[model samples]
Target: MKRNVLLGIAAAALLVSAPSRATQLITEEEAKLPPPKGAVEVQQRGILRGPKVEFVSPGDAASSPLRLVLKFQSYGGAKVDPNSVKVIFLRTPNVDLTPRVKPFVQADGINMQDAELPPGEYTVRVDIKDSDGRPGTAVFTLKVAPK
Candidate 1:
């Protein structure tokens, strides 16, 4: 009876994961890479000098798990890989290693990341480009106080 129950549980687990098995989840490291060549691209019309990126989260707020969101006021209909958006540290946060995350694009114009960070002074930089390879850059100041 025990063996049968274990087997049934294993089978059910596999069934649940089968649909997502083929789906690819983007890694934080991969998020930093440029989007692939064949991604959907719309014409670059009324292009701004650069991507107008802004932070939606508090610039002075400190939390153990920090949430970062950048909204692009104008992208010229360019496509960016949602997974490719990241909060790159100019210098290490308190932790020796940077946090890993799977970033996604929200329905709004924000690219967001939830990062578990150590308490320290931090300057984070975000670099992103449009499908046509036009680049946008933004910097933010964040201070994490140790709890």
Candidate 2:
């Protein structure tokens, strides 16, 4: 009878310990996310050449006339109709900025000069549609420095 009682107590202890083993904490590095695909380039531009967008803003937050530049490149020889493409600018969460959207037309490549944006973090989504209107979109993050 004592052996059976000891076995019962051991079983209860094992059950109690099992719950702690199942409650392991997960680290941020263990939940790392994947990077975005495709080739994307964003820069400040003074001239228009191709399907490129330039984001410009005041070097200081206290200044006016903020702008953004966007440059588009086709991957794997996939030609995107500039006229059928659209650009949407969304203010990043927890940031001071305004949201904007604009349509881009193909003219010797996609080029938008003097595109204005505020000084803050932003998420820019570019959508390119095919002749049939099938769409492909790319999202990029842009940081505008204070004037």
* lDDT by residue (tens digit), candidate 1, 1-147: 999999999999999877531112222344344433332313345656555557676467566555555675435676654444444554322221122323245423453345455565555566555566666666656565565
Off by over 4 Å in 2: 1-78, 91-104, 107-109, 132-134
Residue pairs of candidate 1 with colliding backbone atoms: 31-84
Off by over 4 Å in 1: 1-47, 83-86, 92-99, 105-114
Location of the lowest summed lDDT over 10 successive residues in candidate 1? 92-101
Q: State the RMSD for candidate 2.
A: 18.4
TM-score, one value per model: 0.50, 0.38
lDDT per residue (tens digit) for residues 109-147 in model 2:
333333443455445566565444445555556554555
CA lDDT of 23 in candidate 2?
16
Using lDDT, give the best candidate's number.
1
Cα lDDT, all candidates: 0.51, 0.42
Clashes of each: 1, 31
